[model samples]
Target chain A: MLPMFSGKLCQCLSVTRFPSILFLGVIYVAYVLVGGLIFWKLEGCSCITNKYSLLAITVLKMIKAASLSGLSPDSNDTADGFWKFTSSSVFAATVVTTIGYGNIIPLTTAGQIFCVLFALFGIPLNVVILNRVGKYMLAIERNFSLKMMWWVLTFLYFVVPMLLFKEYEGWSYAEAIYYCFITLSTIGFGDYVADHNPAINYPEWYSCLMAAWIFFGLAWLALLINHSIDLLESVNAYMRRRKNAQTQV
Target chain B: MLPMFSGKLCQCLSVTRFPSILFLGVIYVAYVLVGGLIFWKLEGCSCITNKYSLLAITVLKMIKAASLSGLSPDSNDTADGFWKFTSSSVFAATVVTTIGYGNIIPLTTAGQIFCVLFALFGIPLNVVILNRVGKYMLAIERNFSLKMMWWVLTFLYFVVPMLLFKEYEGWSYAEAIYYCFITLSTIGFGDYVADHNPAINYPEWYSCLMAAWIFFGLAWLALLINHSIDLLESVNAYMRRRKNAQTQV
Candidate 1:
């Protein structure tokens, strides 16, 4: 129940500090608390992480019970074997982008320390990489029709990969497209990871190539979005000036 | 092992495709694979999630053994108690910002679905939020000294929180600053969580408020970083033009 007009016009003009904090408090409850609860209810059913509290399931029947209820899965159900080559490539992509899906994270003390240091170097390096590629792409963009560029981008990053994933892993088209969007946007929910299974024999070179593809793809998306934003801001400025001119009349 | 000099000469070069894809492939190897390995070796020690192979230890003893080692703790070691207010706040913050630091991810099928939908709404809303706040901040920035504003931002977002976290959670100053940097920059490695401890009796309201603080903090950082990049690009463009003019002379 936010007033949406809490600025300048306070309910109690002399005492607004408490109200500001109170407003934040309200947002926390209405937004975070409720949202978390919904997720908790939804995700708790399949959670294998809470094994300690589920004292009802005996050790003898644990495996039998877990399989019967698709919800009781080991955290390693989709684990990248901690260091398998293909999944490791995916891990590297997520970290550099700052998306860090945490699907398969550092498991050792040394690993944690390394993650911090590598991310420190990798994060900035990634930005430089994005900026470099973006500069080149934007320059070349002028020579080609914008629609044609988008068509290529869509086919190369989305349609093509979606088909490959569908064929390679049997994921539906929507799931593959969703994965591409999530990864490129750096949302990286870590749900639809590809070739993470230890049973699969995904090529190391393929994973290596995938990393570059993900980075370049992200840079292109950023360029398009940035261009749109610039256009939007200019239009806004033009509209504002026109309104101001009318007001003067 | 990227040559990084494929530009200028490649505009007229035959078969330019190899150089382009090759550059990205190189980045994938030097950046992702090597970085992933370093993290694996460093963080693998405390990775309690790799329990299947360590079968000599019983499940109950495994928990105890891992707890004693401090490095082999469960993934839910500081879980948000399935939706406890504070952890949930952390969870919500991670998702919307696309940090998705699977430190405390939803384990249920339903939760994952909710997360996808929530992110669709939340990510866009977050950007709109940053845009709206950025507009106001930019207006104010025009009137104020850049250094002063930066100082204020530093103290408000980083310094104050660092101090409070140190006091409240007994974390070192460096740790607090690290957490602030990781979370605000949206890297969110999830190695050093604040209230993930079950031993503590932190209030739910406090955690809820923490989420709002984190969101606003990230938005401010984004605005500041965006401004800096814009300034940097303009300077770079000016310098390049001067260099080109000198060549003509």
Candidate 2:
């Protein structure tokens, strides 16, 4: 019984050559750990800020002082222009686009309600706008090979935007690239925001340009993700057919 | 020339029919404005906690004190548990899931890079999981009419979760239902968070349940959204055919 079980396991292992998924998982684990260590060093090193400060200071001390006294450094930024005309415009753009970066939020009850209402119209309007833009892009991209289309999109969507973001935000190339990926994927982790700080002097038309950029960039990403799904579905269907054919044979 | 112009205008209006989109836009504006008023009354009326204090205190004065004194209420919460195990896990779930409320954030640079890496694997894994779940739902829902599918989904995704959340967070039924809509739509404004403050003494299994809720809830939403697209596409195809037939006649 043991021999038969072992034989079946070996056969299964042989059928699935080169454990790529397992290998990727290991690599991913290592990558995230290293990232955590780096973040711990950069942001979480001190009790004045980072969460790991509890390691040095007792938990009781942290809770007592932090829960009261309003001494946390992060406090000042949360409500910074939480409501203002220009920021409100950006807020509307972000929410409707479904980026919801949570950088500048509606802390007031009114703001939260407005957010919902804004989303109802804004989401549908944005969807219609994005679809229109997508149809145009698709028409232009027609007859292009998938590889060529990808390269063109990468050039237009990723490269140009990364350069612009780096220039406007004074972010490092890595940070700008990271921001592009986060925003385009709509994962929108609000850590690295562009045109957020009013103290930073940007172009007068900066907001307008940025909004247009987001609109077009998101449309491109939607197209790419949708196209990728089609490819995956076809591949899946082909695999299923082959399996059925093999079984019948 | 005037008669010809009038004839063209009439033709355009008839083809467009009720101008439903514009009517919807006006209705949407009214809905959001009403929402804003309600929220203002509920949470924005006071400044001790709400960000709308500037409406009373003068922006210049608040900015001076806030910019200098490091006394932003939001600061304390941003890093409340920015790096603790449960918070980090919650952060991971939020980030990959793209529900980033920004209620908590990694202030350090290292945390940002780690976020990028986590998202790389996590997003794809989530997409695959959601797709599989969507497939199962689509298979099961094949025989059901659109209205019936929508009703079942609302009951499962919205009503059930709303009840669970209200029980867990002690939020009002309205707030719970609002949360269900916001979260499932992935709007994630961060004003109303569940299970954040450990002092609240929620059920021991609360976190586990919340995670499961998010996973399943997101799958249901994915199915609903996909089903909607199919309905819209079929309607669009039918409309186009009818137009073509009318033109031929």
Candidate 3:
């Protein structure tokens, strides 16, 4: 099994991964060089005012803060009460998925950079997680009725948040479901970004909280989508088997 | 058959189409309202200057112009002898996929806007298209032959441009491929945007062309990814069929 896995990995690296990496690296260097030149040229274009400079600095600072915050793993593990929720599989999936709805962006430049790096890493990590989830879903299908399990799992994970969103956000039930679907899909149109409520004066903390919520929610949805796909495959397989058996008979 | 098609259409409308339209409508209204308020507030802010305002206007105008130019569907139909080599199906695929390497783009605001809209429409449209392509691919598959087809498709669509990008743009072959992949993916890390070469120095037209090319290219790449996913689904279905047949036997 190890040999097989390693062989497949080697093939993947040689065929797709290495080439892609090299290609990206070259493009990135060229882009940086060209972008630097453009910025240099534009620097003297009389449009680079002190205010614009300040805004640029602030944006950079914000990005830095977010990155640093992301690198240091969530400290929610230390808390006993409500913090227990953070340790849930749902939360774990969220962080790994990176559906980070700006409600919970980094507060420091280092943190922001870490957050970006984490997101880059998290995309592939989520794919791995989804694969695991897919296996579990397949197991569930074999042990019980696929439809029943799907409904039960989806209700436990998806319907609950959908209801909570409707109530907490004062959204219509349909809109809540829509939000859930959109957020989970990562199409993030930013129509319903969290932590924008004027009531939430602590924007930074609020943003973080919202981001955490979105991340988990999205991960759960991704798992659900994977499971659904697996179930479809299983059903298709079942049908093919019956057809073959009938032919044999 | 008509009834069935209509029923499917109705179901689609109810589930996806209508909701998307409604969602976009709500978003647009909210955007205008919120954007208006923000603009109004910013207008009152003492930090804003006439020059900054002018720059913002210029940027908006440029974007608008590009969009409009892209929408001019009649423009590219007039075959200029200069671009005969770049007008092949494969090259069209390349341009639409955005492996441009500063070789092509629109030269008007109208063109740019059209390109932007085309991209906006094309990404989702291509998803549906690739789903169909996947079905065709599965039907054509015959064991080892299938793998060869995948490689051939990848080489034709991906590798060739990679080589060309390196030779034409002074990029390493790897970087060229990376640029193609990234641009195609619409990740648009904004690292390597198009620059006007001396031969194509009409600034307005050049910018528009770049916009259009990027839009189309990104869409094509997305379509390819979708196609790959569909292929995976087909393989999974095949595996499931075999597994079930074995179990039943």
Alpha-carbon shift of residue A21 in model 3 (angstroms)? 25
**DockQ of all predictions against the true structure, Cα-based:** 0.10, 0.12, 0.04
| Tens digit per residue, CA lDDT, model 3, B1-249 | 556545554554445334444444454334334433332333222221222233343443443454443322222232232123322222223222323222222323332333333333332333333333343344343322636866765675567666645554566654555455445443222223334233333445544444444443443444444555456446555765676688699
lDDT score at residue A239, model 1, on the 0-100 scale: 64
lDDT (tens digit, per residue) of candidate 2 on A1-249 = 556545544543443322432343344334334433332333222223211222223333443354454434442232233333445556566776778776655433444454565555445545544664676566555544436877888887778878888787888777887788778767776666888765788888877777667778888877766666566556656765676688699
Better of 2 and 3 by TM-score: 2
Q: How high is the lDDT of residue B18 in model 3?
A: 45
lDDT of 1 by residue, A76-168 (tens): 443323444434444555665777655555443334444555555455545644775675566455444557877888788888888878877
Rank candidates, TM-score, best first: 2, 1, 3
Scored against the true structure, residue B38 in model 1 reaches a CA lDDT of 32
Tens digit per residue, CA lDDT, model 2, B1-249: 555545544543443422432343344334334433332333232223212222222432444354454434443342332334455556666766677666555434454555666565555545655676565555455444546876887788778877877777887766776677667667675656888755588878877777777777888876655555556446555765676688699
What's the distance in Å from true for residue B122, model 3?
13
Q: Who is ahead in TM-score, 1 or 2? A: 2
Which candidate tops lDDT? Answer: 2
Off-target runs (Cα >4 Å) in candidate 2 are A1-86, A107-114, A117-125, A142-149, A231-249, B1-86, B104-114, B117-121, B142-149, B227-249
lDDT, model 3, position A82:
16
Q: Name every residue pair that clashes in candidate 2.
A: A39-B110, A39-B111, A43-B108, A74-B75, A75-B72, A75-B75, A76-B72, A109-B39, A110-B39, A110-B40
